[model samples]
Target: MTTHSATLREEIEEMIAVGELKPGQHLDETELAARFGVSRTPVRETLIQLASMGLVVIRPRRGAIVAELGPQQLVEMFEVMSELEATCGRLAARRMTREEQQSLLAAHQACLDARDAQEPDVYYYKNELFHEAIYAGSHNQFLIEQTRNLYRRLRPYRRLQLRVRDRLHNSYHEHDGVVQAIVSGDGELAAHLLREHVMIQGQRFSDLMASLPQLRQGAA
Candidate 1:
């Protein structure tokens, strides 16, 4: 909550975003403290917060390490996200205000512009905002919180998927479909489409894993 704490949190998050702190990599408290010109106390506090967010894990003797990205975890997150998004869409269709709909549309346009610029990372961030706008529009606090948590959990893998061949364009098209369904106030259609949209990532991960011999062998 303090300015120093906020800065430490932001720095840690940026490290994760840029892949400097990769999955399953240990976080060196002494090194981080040296880098930030701070004491171990603040660094430890920041690590604890990150761990609470499921971004890092603090073990008894091992300190904090980046959380491992497992296929099962990805599947579980997507399954939960799909259900949350579907419920959000369904509720938004029936309860959204005019301003909320416009806000969602605006976020979608921002995503389109980012896509046009061929900035996949920017597009992905905006795309998250677009879906999050919809979630907020649903006016379900519990759903919003849960969806945000899952989104954070799957952030790294989602970033990886954006780099897949033509996935950016495909994602754009899917967002269009979701917007159309929501705009038409077709709750059932919107819910179903959103569910499918979220699940597609899981399928892609499966296909990706299948194509990687090393991953397949590791699984066995």
Candidate 2:
């Protein structure tokens, strides 16, 4: 994306993330152009990009509407995401170079700082970096690219999930377990820890329903 389109993309995404744009609401290129003080071309391009993020759906001759995932779909999506993360962790445990391991530790520490500073938004961004590092450390280029794509698609829920009560603290401890397993080259333990961390099963699923009603309600 061009710089202009990238900026507009983020603005539109933020609008969706904050509930300013309800699910299935149409995004008119001309209207967005006017709102953002840009031409329709950039707005069009941004909408297309959002579609790729699974945040918007470009319809036939109908422009774009916010994409909505139903409850079953949400659960299914998380299932796949969990498997992908587990695979990354397992691979990273064995493949990560000493330097890469240190980088992952540093990313984990950044999460610690974000939580201590009472910065949920800061933690959110750092959390993405932390996961991306695991995908990278997997040293499997194909898995890295595939995992990164799905990671972007699921960004909003993951960000909101971090805001649930003591979730930051819980996630920190989860990271500690995964980090220890990876540092010790325990692929099995790392994989299990990461699967549990990302899957949002059992109590974690309940936590999402409680904290992010919009996301959960859409599925219902």
lDDT of 2 by residue, 52-90 (tens): 989999999877999876657777888899999999999
> Mind giving the per-residue lDDT tens digits that candidate 1 earns over 1-220?
5567767976676566445677789899999999899998889888887887788899998789988766687677778888989999999888888898899999999988998898977987898899888899889998899888887766655665675567789888988988888888989988998998887454687655554443224333
| Model 2: CA > 4 A from native | 213-220
RMSD of model 2 against the true structure: 3.3
Candidate 1, residue 103: how far the Cα is off, in Å: 0.3
lDDT of each: 0.80, 0.87
Error of 2 at 147 (Å): 0.7
What TM-score does prediction 2 earn? 0.90
Candidate 1, residue 218: Cα displacement in angstroms equals 23
Residue 63, candidate 1: C-alpha displacement in angstroms: 1.7
